[model samples]
Target: MTYKYILPIDTKNVSLEMIGGKGKSLARMASSRMSVPSGFYLTTSAYKDFVQKNNLQKDILNLAKPEIIGRTVSFESASKHIQELINGVELSDEIVNEIKQAYGALNGQNPAVAVRSSANAEDLPDLSFAGQQDTYLNVRGEEALITAIRDCWASLWTPRAISYRHQMGIKQEVVAMAVVVQIMVPSDVSGILFTANPVTGERSEIIVNSSFGLGEAVVGGQVTPDSYVVDRKTFTVKESIIGPKAQKIISSDKQGTILQDVSEHERSQSSLSDKSLKELTSIALNIEQTFEGVPQDIEWAISHGKLWMLQSRPITNLPPQPIEVSWEPTPPAKILARRQIVENIPDPVCPLFEELYLTKGLETPAKGQSRKSFFVGGGPMFVTV
Candidate 1:
């Protein structure tokens, strides 16, 4: 049988169109021999298959329209409705069989895995869609895995996601979600690494956030992670702070990972050893080089002291490097929208409307208040300031 639904993550042969951005990046790193975990990606074909099988495309598309046409619900209501629609649909036997077969290849029976969302519209160099979709870590068994995949698909139509796409001018019909399933790393220490300093845009320094148990505590902002600043060239630690990790999430046999209180003794000590910190930084630098020297925002974990790359993508919305002198910062101004709006507008704005409407100087209903409208372009999409 042809396996159009599922494809291996590490292969260099598949296209981004199939596996989506997150899957393609993982494939790229795996190709470069980076320490990426073994995984499989359920391709966009799978999402299309599910949608087509249930005749869901039309209903979802109409609901997703920014104009709020059918049933006329608020964003929250629309999100709930769309998610309910997806969750209620039955999966095809072929799709279910392929998913089970893929999981069986990973482990003999049921094994813990990470089911993550991979969307075609995310992971762009300029836009950050990292956490907009759902991710289920430490998921166990076939039934749970199936449920996670369905949830990941439902996340594609979430209110935030729908708003993001509409505002960015991405067509709802053109987008699809690919679910990524990977062996769950039994992490002793897990964290995030930024190749370039996120605060000052200094390429010479790498920022690392480390914590106990799973990295989700750090990534999800559930707890304050131990922070570190390491020099890029020398691989020397410059700064460190041990966060108050009073609790952590650890894997459980019956219910995936569970959050429990930490011992008073373990709270004061550093979550990462000096050696581990240096090593994670080194691997992060290597990842930066692997991505053609672009600054990278990487997710990482260490299982049995072996480092693994969970995900990596270009650092979106990074400021210009301090050394670069191509342009200077603009002073505070009353511009309506910035580059995101410019790039998002697919069509040209009308010349006539640009001068007359949205040019400012409007009155308000209140005695002291004046109404001002700021537009994304010369379009009807306006923001009240």
Candidate 2:
């Protein structure tokens, strides 16, 4: 019998279809000499095999049928059922033994890891499933790693994920998941770097968001991180905004991950230094170049005062950026209309706000234009028509 493959992070033989987008990207980065944390990829074949052995496809697909409520499709029941089924299933002996051996080779006993879900359907040009699935951090030991991997597989059936796939008209039976298990970085600071300015659509600038401890604090909205904008050309720190960080997420031997209150003195400090910011920018720029200058969203962690690239994906659905540094306003004959929101709205509108605020209440049917996430940002709160 042909068995599934357990590939290392530096493997160059696998494609995105095999390991899923996140794993493929990380593997590519590692192969290209990028400083990624040592880890391995559990290919989608594992997930497929588990589903096949447990005979879960029919049950999962049945649970994915969308029900029309008062005005829209809802799959709350389907999502819960599918997730329970996924989590309850057991893996085959072949895959389980391979995973155990790989885990042992990672770093002996109880190596801390971050198990992240990498769905085959994610990171598409039109869709950005950035954080729809689960990520278990600071996972130590073989049992914890296995549990985390199972959780990631189950996250493929999460409520938000189900709804997203449903709206996108993707069949549940076709969706498969891979898990990326990386050696955990005990980071002094961890955060994300956008090669292009995600907010202002400035391709010439890069944005960095950093906070204390694990990046979950920054990514989970648990803390407002210090934001830094860097000039792409000169690699200069163009702007910096300090955020009030009230707490931090750190790892403890006793508890895998524990939240500790930030001290009064540390709350006001910037998480990243100018030097580290420059280093991060250079790395991000390199990644963007590797992807043919299409902007990238990268995750990084700083440990032992050195920066490591965790993952990199294309920046999806950015507005057209300015071609020239200096340009003129609209010509007199035609009235100009900017298709963007001019306010300090956050990047990637929250799901609740998108469904409730942006979609339900604020739409103006009279204008004959549905609100399509109007180029969101802040500037005078004025519509230039």
Candidate 3:
């Protein structure tokens, strides 16, 4: 089948050329048993079409060039012109029809969808370009969806995004954006999950940060959330910390999102029980296994007591773990001293050094010193061999 911009669920084997990283990953996840929300992808081809039809290739090329020193007038006018050009373009009929059809297929008429950006370079292993683009929440009907798609495309050129791209050595003109239209889940609770403990990099442990209502308050650092640490192997709840929640963001009946104060009774309560925590941790482990690497950041939501994974990306800021080294037998007193020394060394020292240091006092020389024939510098000398 000859597909244009958007693709349905049946297009499983499409490469990054058909969709972008985010879209392809979502499709792969959906095709599997993972509980991803229903959606379709507005392919990068459509974005390319918009740029080409609007004669933006040369304009983008010009904007991407590094400015000369002391060139004040050049930078300002060029940036302004690019922004104006982007704002002036309108969505074409072909793109609009595909989006409407996809929305209808997922949610029928008058449905609310979450329009999110899935750029070509996001969710990568070496570097994650997260939050560089925009996401529209609780958008209803065709008109709002279309506007949101345009907004997402425009967000690819936000000042912060432009700066990040420049810093990452990614040319703005070479990057393209694909839109992910997902069914909006009206979550009672939402938060982030790390398959490994971010602070410690413990692979056997999983950490969850949750709060009442949508995940925005927690993600935005607007409120402190209740945290739960689970042992991946035993499925045991290791620890839980309940934080004071002042506010929550939720979907509004009017439209978009709204923030409201959480009630006193709900503020200190745990979002998930022991069983639920274990189940969620298992799901996270499954995703990690499926993705074949440890995930750094995971966004999830709980609706009607069932957990759903919204998104996941590698945690780029975490440092590597210290390797373990085995030690031979050592005397008890010496082992105690080694423990004391380890306590003093606050930094993460090499494990091999730690093992050697711990066993240093165990080695003992021969009891009696006897005169033995030994070679010293290729000549015979009287010494212990």
TM per candidate? 0.81, 0.82, 0.81
Q: Higher lDDT: candidate 2 or 3? A: 2
| Residue 254 CA displacement from its true place in model 3, Å | 2.5
lDDT of 3 at 372: 27
Model 2 CA lDDT for position 159: 75
Worst-scoring 10-residue span by lDDT in model 1: 325-334
Order by lDDT, highest first: 1, 2, 3
lDDT of candidate 2 over 1-385, digit per residue (tens): 2335588889897877788988888887898899999988899999998998899998888778888889878877887888899887777778888888887888757788888999999977678898899988888887778888888998898878998987888877788999999888999999999998887798888999999898888888999889998999999888899999898899888437899898889889888888899888998898888777778988898998989998888888787886664333323313334434534542445555656665454455557675532321222222234
- Model 1, global lDDT: 0.83
Model 3 C-alpha lDDT per residue in residues 87-160, reported as the tens digit of each score: 78897888888887777777667777888888887777776667767888999988998989888877777666
- Candidate 2's displacement at residue 205, Å, is 0.8
Using lDDT as the measure, the top candidate is 1
Clashes of 2: 3
